[model samples]
Target chain A: MNPVARLSSTSTGQAAPSGLTGATVATNAAESFPPLGIRRGVLLGLAVFAVAAFLLSLAVGSVPIPLDEVVRVLLGVQASKDTWQTIVLVFRLPKAITALLAGAALSVAGLQMQTLFRNPLADPFALGISSGASLGVALAVLGGAAASVSVFGRAAYLGDFGLVTAASLGAAAVFALVLAIARRVQSVITLLVLGLMISYLAGAVVSVLIYFSIPEQVSAYLNWTFGSFGGVTWQQMRAFAPTLLLGLAAALFTAKPLNALLLGENYAASMGINVRAARWWVTASASLLAGAVTAFCGPIGFIGIAVPHLCRALFGSSDHRVLLPAALMLGGGLALIFDLISQMPGARAALPLNVVTSAVGAPVVLWIVLRRQSFGRV
Target chain B: MITHRFAFTRPRAIHSAPDAPPPNGDESAIRATDLITGYRNGTSRRVVHRGLNLSLSRGKLTALLGPNGAGKSTLMRTLCGLQPPLGGTVWIDGEPLHALSPERRARKLAVVLTDRVDVGYMTAYALAALGRTPYTRWDGRLTAEDEAIVQEAMRAARCEALAARAVAQLSDGERQRVMIARALAQQTPIILLDEPTAFLDLPRRIEIMHLLRDLAHQTGRALLISTHDLELALRYADALWLMGGDGTFVAGTPEQVHRRGELLRVFADEGTEVRRYLQEIHQRWTTS
Candidate 1:
């Protein structure tokens, strides 16, 4: 009986399972980039996305344009094609440019905010810059003041530029208020709460103005809140683009000092930085970029809060030397991607950019809070 | 703490012009003639100290010792330009301190201020490298030489192990070492440390004083440290600046201060138990 059992066991083991033995065999190799090598790969992906985003943006919208025709049109060469010319020149090109600049500006502003406030949660809107600018725009458009200025200034051919200039100044006034508050309030949470409170206060004012105002003006003011790249035409782009670029360039230039700011103001000063002046410039740039985008393209929020986190997670270093460029590329790409998602299902079914951003952004923010709670900020 | 208890002899007024610096640069290293330091509250005011005269120079490790509110820290802050001298000027290289560029002043003098540092996300290397900020361009990139000096500073303060770690995670003593590292990295001719060893354990405290004295001797850099540790101060200092009540003050070589009995005058009170402790320390060290 024992012999028969041994023979039966031997027979059962006759067919041995085979295992793969080559280098191609699945192994527990790291699926994520190593810390140092991450920067190179993320940066590469960012560049690819930035280019792809540009093409996708150019090929999108109600007008049907092929990618090759759009590319030709973009190059300033005559597209032998007709609809391509209209699509590229009229719709996609301006929207694409607006989306790109807006993205870059918001991300850089976010990066500055996080560094200055020393909080990972700080973003362009965290200071209430967008809300403040929105209030300014609402006042201008609804107060019957901007309408009069628009008519008289454009009638004289000088008011066209005047409106945008007024808009920027209006936004700047609120930014200054926030900066002063930020100076006195030392804690980041206090500043953040202050910003949120300011936003609510501004919203209240806007609501009162809208309730007392005519329906048409109310609709226009309401439209600005949904956010749009479509509003910034070539003329608006000309006025808006420089403001965004200058702010971005300044943030990029300030990368090193931002590293110093991690040491706190007194230490930063002892380190030979003009601490007061640096704080001023940081506040000013964050406001200027966020305000301009809000003024021209409406209040775009979630991108400013999300892109830096994404960039930091991808690159694995808070050093601005690598982080700034990565943030810039990733920011521009993310903006275009969000814009693409918003524009899905054609013109009639198009969504707001803020809606798309919030959809992506809220979850990331929740993930951040949960992760931070589960394990500290380490 | 050697109490010589000698007769006081006031210094004769040298008939040099106020504007003309003396040819002897050593005498001109630091001078506070009848300085009055204080604070303002709206229209009201209060004085912290008055009629103070102190001079320091290169090749000296000076210690300022006093009870709390003897205006020691206030005076130190005023002298270092963190607070404006209410009734006098802080002159460096015979010019008003306020007139100098921040960078120029930083190069001439470095300070390790009382710590309330809140620099999160900064590495020890980053913190030490900040000492070279005045010498750096607006972009603030450190040169190879700057990097070397920062590394040397880490070694000098025995913080080489903590170089890559975040400043927040460091212990109090380690933080003190980091701050000293920063000042050392500054490479200035005049360095001031505010209670540099306050957070340190006994051995580390002695190590810091030894490092300061050796650094002063080798580099001929003037070092001024304020502390309440009478024993350590007496043992290591080149001179003692004693701040007495009602703005009474005297600064001299350790021998001179002992002879003048200023330590006994400021400390060793007849009533309080705290004074008894001071008396005991004073007696023990002075006798030794």
Candidate 2:
């Protein structure tokens, strides 16, 4: 007889080998809690931090309005000077709100990209979005009559609208191309590599444009690249806010499929998730969030790459349900804090938003990578 | 006593009528008819097998055995609806496989593959809860009943204690059990697995085979496993599907296939001694 039959015949009543007994099976079923209480605590803390950061950003700008006055004006109590009111309500409030939206939007996009690609290093900007937006602005300022149009009437108004429009369209075009390529590629690493190549291609195009453009236009492009949240007006927010909200909403709906995708495509499909449809939804939502933010905020970096890592580290869970809200709060809070620091409080010259963001964001990403001891997630 | 007499009278009359189809056909959970398995490269098709007919009956454990390059994975993939057949039809529990939506198909058939799941942060319970994906709402929130089902699947797969543990931290055997629990939580009538024992040690391999066999018999669910462990397959599996070197398939009881010498046809090319060894084993089994 065979060894299997010989063993089974020797041990008639027992189901499995002695090594795997009922007692051992019972012992093997050890349970561990997922730190949900801690996650809730982190969420609450982030929410508070985000609110405080927003208030600080509004109160500590060039005029340095008192916190009480900032609150009073915000509550419409009429305690501050009219000039202070104008700075607080007109200039700083919208800018702070823009910072909040851009931070949340980019962070959520980054989370989706990281999860979908199963790569920890993937960011919203990885798909050439920032470069695409830069090329758009470059073409408008250099190739078009944007400079001469600024020389005409209503210069600030027309110029901002034209640049925002150009940036949006340019980001959207590159996003469409990435999605088109993504459909054919099954491997996440391949998709990420394609995104990197596209970024390089867009960067090359932007460099050629920069070389030939006038010095003033070149400066304009360079200044935009440094990034800021100061220029988004109420009119712009109407466009920016809704798109970000819609993208976030779409992302939340994909929370289930995104979790399934963590196991890879074959497993996700077996779980009844239409892999292709989920991929499309993820790509569309990620593109909309990142693309719209770049159009308005000049492609703010770091938060998109860093906030998701921060959320994962805090919550100790990969479930999108928790990570989504956590990222939103943390991203908004971080962006507001950086914006406040960049304003230089008492000084007239403000630091570039990207400089403040990268200084903060790069360290967090580096620390996470080292702590995890891996550069890319499997 | 009158009720007992009545039960016997009516049931006996009904049971006497031969209304049921042949046992195999009546219990078939999945059937493939004249399946042409192959891969498509650009405009050309490389066919693996043609005129293939196979039936996996409910409450049966079938072991799909084949050598390397025998297109076992391709056939398994095609049967699970992961890839479209080159030219054939697959029916699941009386419904056309293609006619069912992915959600509907999931409700009918669950698949367990050898691919490693790299989700580090999810607990085993949450991963198993994903099996309720088809039944859950669009947002994928688990209702109380869904949670109970997930818990029951974990218990059945003997991973209940590991429910709270991170999937990434689990050992290979533990992870495989959790994956099986996830498939069980899917609650489908038919489960297809590709090399479920590929990475396991000898004891774990035997244990997994026993577990799968018990699950199939107890749940009345059909299990079709593709594996390289022919010894365990012959011992535990109720039926065998052997893929030949020339891309043909034969299905029968292990004893029947061995008696018919079809096993030799597939294993002969491995070596003359291997074939002789198999013949010797067959002689001992038959004599015993």
TM-score, each model?
0.78, 0.87
Tens-place lDDT per residue, model 1, A50-113, is 9899898888666656788878887898897776787788777888889988998888888888
Enumerate the chain B TM-scores of all models: 0.85, 0.89
Runs in model 1 lying further than 4 Å from the true structure = A1-45, A60-69, A78-80, A125-128, A141-166, A175-204, A210-220, A312-318, A345-348, A363-378, B1-24, B27-30, B41-45, B198-207, B253-261, B267-271
Per-residue lDDT of A161-253 in model 2, one digit per residue for the tens?
777887887898888887887777766677777778878887787787777767877787778788888878999899889999999889889
Worst 10-residue stretch by lDDT in candidate 2 chain A?
A19-28
| i-RMSD per candidate, Å | 24.6, 11.7
Candidate 2, DockQ score (0 to 1) = 0.28
The residue pairs found clashing in candidate 2 are A29-B161, A29-B162, A30-B161
Model 1 agreement with the true structure over B1-288: per-residue lDDT tens digits: 112111001001111224346234545445665677888666776899877767777667999998788898888777766666768666664666677566666766788877576654456666777787777776666766667556556655556667777676787778787788788777666778899888779988897888777656544567899998887888899988888765678788877777666787876443587677766865775777
Per-residue error for A17 in candidate 2, Å, reads 28
